[model samples]
Target: MKHLNTFNNTILYDFMELFHSLPYTFLGMEKSKDAFESAKVVLLPVPYDGTQYPYKGAANGARAIIEASRHIETFDDELNLELEDLGIYTLDELEISLESALETIKRVQEAVEEILDNKKMPIILGGEHSISLGAVRAINAKMENVSVLQLDAHADLRNEFKGCKYAHTCVMRRINEISHYVGVGIRSMSKEEKEFIEENELDIYGTNFNSNEILEKLKDKVYITIDLDVFDPSIIPSVGNPEPQGLFWIEILELLKKIAQEKEIIGFDIVELSPNSNKISDIYAAKLICKILSFSFFSKF
Candidate 1:
């Protein structure tokens, strides 16, 4: 329902360094029809961060990441190649009114299905952790054997919560309906979720669990879903739910690198970053997306 404001537009302009005198898109380049579709990877931004426990504004997560992306160097110093070589595509956000979360999830599911049907991997930036439900369903529409790699502070496996069956608390429970998954860096869990896991014999590795054990359990083609709360609050305090202690940025990077080395990451989503005017969190989220994209390519090479 809310679009970019003038101040936000000005910020985007400065970051992109574009010649506004001429008609151009975000990166100050012409929209490449062929190059865009032929792209191996696609970025989908869904600005619908609803159903929060602590803070609000994760709805702004997509815009914040896209804005900060302008500051990203096209040529990766670490990989020593232009990311454009992989043919990245960025789409305008699909329509959503933010009135109902369930309706938004259905819309997301449709958009995600289109991406998967095209045979291109989708990197969805979240409005909330609930957005993962649509992405998980999107993958299920086509793949025979798919597994989710959830990196979060809490186990989002509740069958229902807050009188909402499709609450953010129930995202993983919905994913469980379609396929198996591996949960990593989990430091929060409820008694109900614990019983559900024990009874179903699910693949869950808590914060106390070993990374190596979880890595080996992943399937060949995987969909990764990250709730930003997985990071220690000291490191990423701007998320909706700030858990005291969790994984470090580099530790997550290393974990992703290991997963990329071992499995094919079909899709991913980074949810629950509520940006502030301070701007550090925005750039951090952007860098995280860029790093994951780079890792995805570097591992294959």
Candidate 2:
């Protein structure tokens, strides 16, 4: 009996070591049986931040988020559920095209289309906000009556920026051409974007807007695009363009829960997480993703 106990302990240690050494997955959980086929949610990491200018480290955001995710506990105390049960599968980081921003976006669109075809929900970890354009395009192609819910500090309504239509600043402009969108948490924008918003009579809500009013503007099917800069810089200062006076943690979570109950979240992306020396920002972003997933899919569980 003593020999058997020693052998079992040795095996357990080996198994734990192997698990920890494996390639990082979201929440550091073991893959489920037939991970891709059985997974209700798939994480598509696009580590291409070619369009980001002025601040350029956002290309490293996706990997940082994945690495930080390994440290998070899988159990959600608030929801009283295990997040690992959701079968979240993380795909290899997408190979980015250095040729041009448009080519990269095209690749993103193709990747997202395949995920949608498989009947899996895609949670894209973006290199920058521009990647959301591809995911939105893919979603719009397959589903009708889709509206984009953008949570960001910038309106991103510019027709072009730095001679690139697909630049991170112009992502929502490209998306607006494809589908209707509503912007929230907007406290920064150029005069061009402001004029465009007025000219188009767009639905953009600022920091003080009512959540219920915003909900009324959304359609039955929603594709959410979250730029980490939407959060207050004091809470998450590791974004490409951190702005002051942003949304707090609880407020964002509460709104997400309300949306989860009210509408269908087709897919979502969390972008512009330029990781710095602050490890807390990385962990916070990882936790935010898990919480959003928990709220989005809590009904299925």
**Best model per TM-score:** 2
What are the per-residue Cα lDDT tens digits for candidate 1 across 1-301? 1455877877887876753442222222235788666688777888886676656798888878777777667677987767767776778876765677788888888988998888888989878888888888888887866789999998899888777767688899988887889998888888999999899998887666666887778888889998888887777777887777798888888888778777778889989989887677767777777777777788564
Error of 2 at 2 (Å): 38
Total clashing residue pairs per candidate? 1, 0
TM-score to true structure, per model = 0.87, 0.92
lDDT of 2 by residue, 9-100 (tens): 99999988887564588877566558777888889999988988898888889999999999879889988878878888898899889878
CA displacement after TM-score superposition, residue 229 of candidate 2 (Å):
0.4
Among all windows of ten consecutive residues in candidate 1, which has the lowest summed lDDT?
21-30
Looking at candidate 2, what is the lDDT of residue 274? 95
